[model samples]
Target: MKFTVAICTYNGQDRIPEVLDGLQQQTNPEGIEWEVVVVDNNSSDRTAEVVSQYSKNWRGDSQLRYVFEATQGAGYARQRAIQEAKSDLIGFLDDDNLPKENWLVEAYRFGQEHPQAGVYGGIIHPKLDVPLPPYFNKIKSLLAINNPGSQPFRYQRNDKPRKVPAGAGCVVRQQAWKERVPKQLQLQGRDEKNKKTLLIGNEETEAFFYIQNSDWEIWHNPAMEIWHHLPSKRLEKEYLLKLSRGFGLANHKLRMVRLYPWQRPLMILLTPLYLLSDGYKLASYYLRYRHEFDSDLTKACELQARIGRFMSPFVRA
Candidate 1:
């Protein structure tokens, strides 16, 4: 069966080259036709220029194509790619990630081996120049490690047949996703006001949830890998704060999605407590790690509270 690699990018000029290069190097099966489709999510940078350059020069057997969507969201780009995919199997990779040469090969192999599964995900690693702190590394040990260009992970035990992840490195059947995900939920992407902000989080998680409920098996292959680049900006405290707030907002949205309508009322009561405790732990971590003092602690704490307030009324409304 033919497979199409769908990539979504937003202002990804500097990173797209390596990803394209990695794709060009991939070795596919003799009869399997593969192609790459890049959906540009309204990039203001030289992203289009870079991809255009690569498309012109790529020598791979798989075709390369670039499409532009002015809607300004990753979800929007992803949805467009899904619609345009020419293959029955669709693989997703971020512009910032460098996937392995045999990534799609392994994905197809697993799909053939277990025709029951609709979704499959591989490993991901952070391409960091500096070593993470001991505490962070310890936590990461339990999770996937990010190294530049190479990430290794052991396959999750297949004992429990549960919902699997479609985030990062994943290949999914087009027919399965179209049947399981609502058009409304697939509209994930960047916020219109601030292009840098993601409109949703846990989008893949939500999709996997639906797939699981549909009685589709989600598979995990630890052998396949992708190296995710981490810029210095992502390492800063402010960005981490933004990430936390976004995560909190996503949690709020999941509740609104009626995933747990019965538990929504409980969240309303627990939100304030949870935000306060989270703020305290983050504040302590900041005070210990960051030597310079800043009163942004107050602002950060207030932001978390504001998110809770915003979510509370939205659920009711």
Candidate 2:
């Protein structure tokens, strides 16, 4: 089956060139059909202009196209990609992600070979615009830096199913998106405004569990790798807290989604208990890092996320 490299960008004219360059560098085997589809999610900048220029310069068998998703969220852009993509497998690369040259080729090969896995993801290392902070290694996992080792395996950690695929460098089958996600699940993801200010968002994470429940297996293909750009701004204590809160909110939403309609009422009754459990976990982490400069960030983030999750029921879709 052919593969579609789907990059979601919002006001990314400045940051998208590297990602486009990475795609232009792809080494495709003859007869392998693939394409690059960039979903411009309501960009205020010249993101479309940059992509249009690159489309003319694309050299590989993969054709480049620019799609405009007027919606502001990444989830909406992703859903648009699902519709716009011509291929069965859609490999997602965030706007700032710099994929390895073989990313497209390996993704196509892996999806072609592994029919059982509906979704597959690879490693994501940090592409830092600034020097790494001394405390970075302590929270790399939270930062979305994933290695999962050089050995390829099914999506699992310590013999349990992995929670979510890496945000970027994730290759998902159109079949899975069609079967598991009938439509974009409420479009609860980051907007440019949120990223700049609140930082509260979880665009794709919640869908992982929904897809898994549909019996679509998830996998890790080590050969498919990308570098996710982490600017100095994202490395700040405040941003981490915001991201952490987003994670919590997303996790709660995932749990809420798993409930049957009949169970939601009872789940509502049990919400406090659930939040309390999360609170304890947050407290434990806080105590562990309390002396550090960013000690309270995680705890505060969890609190904010839990609050958002609890309020999710009231939010109109």
TM-score top scorer = 2
Q: In model 1, which runs have C-alpha deviations exceeding 4 angstroms?
A: 29-31, 138-163, 186-189, 196-200, 255-317
Per-residue lDDT of model 1, residues 1-317, tens digit only? 28889998878888888899898888866557888899888778998888888878886577888999888666677778888899878889888778888887887677777666778787777776566643344333212343322342322323353334546778878888898877666326345337444234356666666665565677667767888776666555565455545544555554444344465678768667766765576566556645433544434534553454344333321
Q: In model 1, what is the error at residue 118, expressed in angstroms? A: 1.9
lDDT of each structure?
Answer: 0.66, 0.75
Per-residue error for 180 in candidate 1, Å, reads: 1.0
In model 2, the Cα lDDT at residue 292 comes to 60
Give TM-scores for every candidate, taking all chains together and pairing residue i with residue i: 0.75, 0.87
Clashing pairs in 1: 73-190, 74-189, 75-188, 75-189, 125-146, 126-146
Highest lDDT model number: 2
TM-score attained by model 1: 0.75
Q: For residues 1-317, what per-residue lDDT tens digits would candidate 2 score against the true structure?
A: 37788988888988899988888778876568788899999888999889888877787576899999987777788899989999888999988899998888898889879987888889899888888887677567667788887988876422443466676889988888788774758535777745532323455666665676666788889999899898898888777766665555555556666654466678877778876776676666557655763455544555555555555444444
Backbone clashes counted, model 1: 6
